[model samples]
Target: MTEQHAFSSKVLQEDCLDYTPFLSSVTLARRRAARLVSEWGHPDIAGDVALVVSELAGNALLHGRVLGQLFRVQLILTAAAVRIEVGDACGERRPEVRNPAQDEKFGRGMVIVDALATRWGVVPRTVGKTVWAEIDLR
Candidate 1:
């Protein structure tokens, strides 16, 4: 679903989708995020937004999946930035960045997010947590 909010006279556009906790949802989330960003007149940041969405959604699937619970992806757009948020039911399992060996094949999602996003963090919810990243449009 989509909604528009007004904050300090600026219109903030938001789109949210919930996905079943599955590996396939990661790809879906990435594609949807890219399309929404592009459609909102920010094609230049779509690629970066997609990458961030992929990482966050993948991390949610891998680390935040709870039985029978769905994860949510939300995109918030303003004049200056776009924020991507992934919320899952497993709140206790927080995400952390790992420095893996060069030969290691896993563990670099947050690093990629950190590099691309201007800022990112976790927000605790009553049932779960929302992991979010923001990319500046300037």
Candidate 2:
């Protein structure tokens, strides 16, 4: 009799998009995030993922932009969840969840991120910081 064996493998899926510090970058980032989420086999959570990406990328452009520097958006897909990260060149300005006034138009980005993300925080680097948010698809 011949013995038979089964083979299995695990692979990590990840991608990144770099953008200039232009205000229009936020729109591009959100669009790309939605498309990538769908392409990464998570169409079910594409809406939430895209919204989070918009907030994070908007925050980076509004608060973390530095002259002559660029920002990056990264996505990591795991078995149970997806992680999104936005890296910018301003380390001093950190993200915070603020309750804006009724008439306020801004200061709500972090609030939205906090409400949707399973977990989110900031990661400081040598020259800047990366704000990351994770969404559970399970």
Candidate 3:
């Protein structure tokens, strides 16, 4: 599968559950999604998608994760591009690109994602919004 990601990739999809207010699990899932894309012979692109997933997943957890609610991470790799989607139990917040000052030690994840992704957007979900990004593989 990884090889295919590197060479002639097919559609790739993976799901990971979001537990309590934690980040370790989501991080691993994003890496796995990257690995799947790498298998398709697109390690570089996979890495890009993985990073986006990481940031989005983190955002989902940080700003969207709520009490008694769970978040979900999904990665899709098509022939033309790779898409990353992260959904959480949020309904009152939004994501935007920010510029972090020199002293700031956090809050720059989305900037990186926005720079790498060819296209990105947000979609309304039952609970919250699904933040997504697409990276061209061709």
Clashes of each: 0, 0, 17
Ranking by TM-score: 1, 2, 3
Off by over 4 Å in 2: 1-11
The C-alpha TM-scores of every prediction are 0.90, 0.89, 0.82
Over 4 Å off in model 1, which ranges?
Answer: 1-11
**Once all C-alphas are superposed, what RMSD does model 3 give against the true structure?**
6.5
> In candidate 2, where is summed lDDT lowest over 10 consecutive residues?
1-10
**Residue 138's C-alpha lDDT in candidate 3?**
66
lDDT string for model 2 (1-138, tens) is 011112122326788989997878888988888898899888989889899999989888889988888999998887777888899999999888888999998999888888888888888889999888888885
lDDT of 3 by residue, 1-138 (tens): 001123245666545455455878666777777887888678877777787888888888789978887777776767788777778778678788888898998889878987998878777767688777778876
| lDDT (Cα, 0-100) at 127 in candidate 3 | 68
**Model 1 whole-model lDDT (C-alpha atoms):** 0.87
Evaluated against the true structure, the overall lDDT of model 3 is 0.74
